[model samples]
Target: MSVYTQLTNDQFATFCQSFGVSFVRAIPITQGIKNSNWFIQTTDDVDGAYSYVLTLFEERPPADIEKMAVILNQLDGKLPVAAPLSVIESNSVQTDDDDKRYVIHYEDKAITLVPCLAGSHPEQTTQAMCHDIGAALAMLHETLQALQPAEQYGVPLYPWADVRDREMQFMPGDEAKLMSDIWRSYTELPLTTLPNGLCHLDMFADNTLWNLQKGEEHLTGLLDFTEVSVEHYVMDIAITINDFCTTWGMAEQGESVNFDRSKMAAFLQGYESKRALGLDEKRALPVMLAKAAVIFWLLRLNVIHYNRTEGRTGDNIMVKNPDLMKRLAAYHWAHVEKSQNTVFVLSGTTSDNQIIGVFSSITQAEQAREKLSNSSEFAIKEYTLDQLS
Candidate 1:
């Protein structure tokens, strides 16, 4: 939502008139990183004033943008999504032959107008907010289940997969290996059997709006559907949890990162209130959390890389620190390990039926027992985590 492209007032007024309204003014919205966004004000005889968000497709292809617009239209009344306003007449390549939904062509790019939603971006998150977001996310997925896979909609699946190899070329060996290891763990999961649907892969706090003016705060809108994709339900849940449950700090300040268990519980409970999660999804949450962190780490690095290589330096260009995500990935992995390490002890006749070793995961404990020479008499003694839960 940066002002990458500058447009004259007259040019904007002409565009506004195409929608049958007179443009009052336009203000650049410089909060996001991907596209050029503006808060546009228009007026008509019937309505004195009205506001809308104008977005120019900066990086995404025109085809993908159209699909996103259609998706928003489909989800508008159900969710607080900003559905694109249809053009009165076809001005550009028609998005659909039977439908009047169209995007204006501007310099070989697409532009869209959507209603400016109420409320402001929340500065901080609470358990109530997390709960509300979780229920909303579940509703989104459930509603999207009727649509076909992302490929049918011309949307990419697992967007980060396209840039992983290229981004690794620029990463340090340690960071690259960390990324690969976590990614490998995620791929090894039973993803094919897990529940599948379109996911709001980016559900950060700022991407949502809340009615802070009222005594009771509630979510009023969900913004930025650019990162939507077809993926496992657990992966989406993990991505949302990574942002909502984690406490972040400025990378320059070297503050510590922490995850709030209570917030996570509330989010899960809220999600369960709408739709129950499968056992496989429950088991995959820990590693999926780590995987989600890696994706964002890669995204931040990609943004920084392009900003330097493409000479896109400006106050309007918002570049987040990649180090914070790197630290977050490490924290998630450690948390997974800590949760997995339930002190599994291997006993076998080879060691006179005594304890042989302690392991974190069940697979690691089984592998250790297989390595023993006299494995037939071996038995694995697992410690119960009755207190932790």
Candidate 2:
């Protein structure tokens, strides 16, 4: 009952044949959000055996497919991540007899077949993993900064920001109002200025695969670059912190969870190990984290929730609660308040003073009205005023 289109076994075999991969067997891998994925096993006549992941992009536009491919191509060597192989030359993917192209389908969705990464995702986030993730992110951010802006691929540091704004407009009642208020708070905050580059916007825990060979979890590869865009480094940092440090559900339940400040520090340490964040970038972490929370909330509300309402259900996906949006806002605000020094407030001296003065005047006026109400002449004057006026 997944909303995404599924490729039949025969059609999948033909698709693999087109890419010179003679498929022996194919099994669906149910671990993605926006696409239907399958692990296709191919007989390697000379090499022995191999498997590749066929990602049938459901509900994704061709423009997004091309944009991700182009960005991934640019980021291939820069970070430890997976990039889709080009079936046809010049960033265009091929299709089977069913008219399914490598990155586009007849159903107006994008599809791509990627080499299956040979690592398992860690069940829990550890300090070592956090450090590696931090370093990986930092390295990725550095690489992105070195590259040119990819406006075609929608590469703003806060790409989801735009999406959230659109979704808030359509949501109902208090939910929509709360979303709007959080978005306004983010907009009002001064943003960090950093060099723009390609960003892997969806680097959550599930997207990361780990290799635990040496009794220590090492980051094997980063997966799912569908949300790749051009954005600031802090935005990525904010997302990492929100995903790894703040969310309790991500950690083992009933473990007496504490916000691993050391893990947080380790992540920052790794990031700085590659390229140092500027003063503005470091300062903007709390606001960026708040923005990240709001962004994820809206994404769940609009994309996941809407899909569920349309009857899309699967092993890996579920509709997010609307109430969680308020909780997320509160969490972000608490963090932002604690880290206010890092946040850039956009109010000027004159504007700030005027606001304070207005509040003071309102307080004084309320006190004067209360004093007048307690006086005996107050009722007489009110009656006289009513008669005269």
- For this target, which candidate reaches the highest TM-score against the unseen true structure? 1
lDDT of 1 by residue, 1-389 (tens): 67788899998887776655568888889987788988887764234334788888787777777888777877778989888777766456546644765577789888888888988887667788878899999988888776675556536764677678988887789888888888898888888889877888889887898898645888899998877777788888988988888877655657557777667767877787798888788778879989989988888878877888888977889877777788888877776666565666777756467887865544345545655677667777767566653
Which portions of model 2 miss their true places by more than 4 Å? Answer: 1-3, 45-50, 88-106, 153-181, 192-194, 250-258, 314-317, 320-328, 338-389
All candidates: TM-score: 0.82, 0.72
Residue 21 CA displacement from its true place in model 1, Å: 3.1
Candidate 2 global lDDT: 0.61
Deviation (Å) of 193 in candidate 2: 3.1
| Model 2 lDDT per residue over 141-232, tens place | 66655445457555334356676667767767876765666667767756534555667777878788888775667877788877777666
Candidate with maximal lDDT = 1
On the 0 to 100 scale, the lDDT of residue 157 in model 2 is 47
- lDDT score of residue 202 within candidate 2: 75
**Alpha-carbon lDDT, every model:** 0.78, 0.61
